[model samples]
Target: MKSPLVVLTGLVICCISIPILTSVVSYSNIKQETQTKKNTSSQSSKLEKNEIIKKVINYETVNKETPIINVYNHKLGKVQSMNMEKYLYGVLAGEMSAKFDIEALKAQAVAARTYVSYKQGHKNPSQHKNAVVCTDFKHCQEYKSYEELEKVNGSKWIKNSYSKIKQAVDATKGQIITYNNEPILPLYFSTSSGKTENSEEVFSIKYPYLKSVDSPYDKISPKYTSALKISNKQFVEYLNKSYGDIKLTENNLKNQVKITQLSKGGAVETMKVGNKEIKGTDVRRIFNLNSANFEIDFENSGIDFIVKGYGHGVGMSQWGAEGMAQEGYKYYEILSHYYSQTEIKDTY
Candidate 1:
């Protein structure tokens, strides 16, 4: 038989050993779980880092080069190929004044570039004949080479101005305005009569981004207001020349002419002269008025045309851009303001 003291000592030892064994197993389980969590977190971090690296590689892999464009020199009647960026320098010189703010010039550059891209995509083979665009202001955007610019502005102006124009072009290189992943028409004009017109109202084609918008800063344009007085006989003769034979007399001008419709932008849409209905655009063309927007007042011996603004008044206003730039708006911001629901995208 065993001693009672010995038995009691054994029982005490068992009690202490049981707790130690339980603690060891519990600690082992906790360590394993902690290791598993650490491994998962490390794997997630590595995957995130790998994704970042892949994106960096993809961005670095793309190579961009300046595009070459074929321009038809309408005066010379020759197609000339040159760098697109160089073309923009000439376009900026011809379209917008060099004295404009850098931001405004940049905005014009992007618009001109987008215009070229859009035209290139929808090439009127008959109009340009293998040329991407023409130098004619009536047909395509205006473009003036360094030689032409020097002749027009003098060598002194070129020395002081060309650098700024080049800077504007280079700063926004390979950028174009896009709506719905396509280049927009990018129409622009000298000024507006406080607002822009919808594309449908002016061009008979509707575009969502080309909706009417307010442009109150165009008053700064020198062509904002103009007046021309034409004698009753001259007015009647001009109308007759354009619109076949119409029953109209010099003295009865006030009673015979009637404005039939006005555009939402407040420009004349149609007018009736005697028995003939003439489009406001046709009238402006026949009379050489500054724009389609005009008001006719009958005078004792003549008719006076009071004109406001210039150009088609259907898109970005040049003077309005200058005003926005002067107000500290960035080029992109100016574009976004003028072209609704559009995005600036890099062209590669």
Candidate 2:
């Protein structure tokens, strides 16, 4: 979790045959740029209509014991423990936007809570001791404090967005998805590639609740399409940077990139970069592309990668959940649609 300060390191790359770096700025001052501040609109939205009635929630009071989560701040190298419900406010704020449907937010709240619940004992090796999770995108869920939300979300939507996230967390207090009375890890991502992939395909682990399923609604996601173009020179540079043995000449550049395999969800499973076979995940990381579900186009000027969907195609799709919520699906129904054979359990 980066504190309230946002930083950026900038290099002005000149558009020439050979790469030219004109200006370099300090990483700490990168956030001081005008455009960087403009990127802070937290797109956090509508609660779906529900037939289930609201009841007295909060397992803390019901069980006569408050549940607390030890969160390790990766940047600060400190541990902070708070009531589980309070932690979710930051999770929901950090994970999903405020503009999402209220039901979708609630669904995210449940999934995030369940994920932490299942990962309580299996802690990340952060600097702090007894830390259940770290505020890192790769290790654990992203977390944004209320104060951070205020700065990033701005003054206009800050109050309302916080209110919506808080309501979702409060409404689903102490509720988690379980299978056979055991808490299940409810993994979720930004969006899917028209369908969600099975757990085995992505992580090579089998979970009964994680299965491939049609998520046609994901097609309507805002991030459904992304296009990036790499010049011939730039493409060669990136390839040589990663795989020093890459030998793609100007004539063979068009045919150098090949799709070796495809995942069940139609995402690139493995791709051949010249002589090296690399995972699509690696390619996505190398280019900072939105997702692995992409297609490459060779043109006279450069090569273009048109990506579909976003994030890892596994578990629940956030935008898919929002689409379902917009179509009048309840929170639990949306959860069941994504998590397969799972039960919604109330610990209280």
Candidate 3:
């Protein structure tokens, strides 16, 4: 009925209105769905986080009273009696937290127990003997009695040795450590090979027997050399084998060996053996080749050797500890001297 222009305008208005209404409804629905999803996701995530925290918080409390039993070797009998605390103390004592696992702790407990029992009465199980009450090796120099040794060495030597033995017995709980389950006795070596002119030649009495050698430092045998020589390429191979797979290059050689990460309360380090990247704990086990008590042949060296020191190089060097103790260092001070980034806590 209206003019052609008016009819066209009315049609255009209707078309635009329909589309605008549809778009507004679709957007409202989409916004509601998105908000619902976000709320659900946030709640789920919060629940997961709370569960993880709860588990962590309950771990110590749950395991605190767990009964720890003594693990024994059938050959040696009951090695040692311990609960968690005592076992933990033993691992810490050896600076072995990096390699510490339940199995390792059990092994250490056995060793500690066996050592303690052997020290207590294994020397002469049938007979009870009084503890060795002397000051130093010098005092035990074929002297008839403590009085005689004291007279010869003087009051200082007597006091030092007595104090040393007391401290040693107390620290080890009167346990006699066996190199390979045999009693570790004082081993003596002549600083100068083939009987010396000096009556009191420099003697090393503790573990990892350090002997004075006449050979030039460079000419020193590879066994005695501490520097591990490996080319850049070889180091890469070593790392792959020892640590599975890792990012390594000639550039990493600058750091050499270093603790890269810690896992399950253990230290993980990047170490190069030959020319490879190996990741694991560093345990230094030292062996002595110069003890006269145990004979060795340079040509065909085959001896049932008994050695000491649990992990790499030399540890708290017992002789070194004794020296520090003599100089009035306490037990804690002696422990701190050898280990870094460690705190002393009561085992009990």
The global C-alpha lDDT for each of the candidates, from Candidate 1 onward, is 0.89, 0.80, 0.35
Candidate 2 residues 1-348, lDDT tens each? 654333222222224412422233444466566545554432110112132334213333344354887888886778888888888898899999889999999999999989888886455565346888778868789988877877877877776778889999888888889887788878899888898887776777988998888888887788988899988878787877888887776565668888999888888889887778988888888888998888999987688999988988888999999999898777888988998888887765
Q: Flag regions of model 2 displaced more than 4 Å.
A: 1-65, 124-128, 154-158
User: What value does the lDDT take at residue 223 in candidate 3?
Assistant: 29
Global lDDT of model 2:
0.80
lDDT-based ranking, best first?
1, 2, 3
Residue 326's lDDT in candidate 1: 91
Lowest summed lDDT window (length 10), candidate 2:
42-51
Question: TM-score for model 1?
Answer: 0.80
Q: Write the per-residue lDDT of candidate 1 for residues 1-348, one digit (tens) a residue.
A: 999999999999999999999999999999999999999999999998897565331112223898899999999999999899999999999999999999999999999999999998898888988799999999998999989889988988888999999999988888889999999999999988888888898888998888788888888899998889999999989888876688889877899999999888888999999998878888888889888889999988999998888988887999999999898777887888889999888886
The best candidate in terms of TM-score: 1
**Global fold similarity of model 3 (TM-score):** 0.26
The clash numbers for all candidates, in the given order, read: 0, 11, 18
Can you write out model 3's per-residue Cα lDDT over 168-223, one digit (the tens) per residue?
32343322223444433322211211111111122213332122212111111222
Candidate 3: 10-residue stretch with minimal lDDT: 190-199
Ranking by TM-score: 1, 2, 3
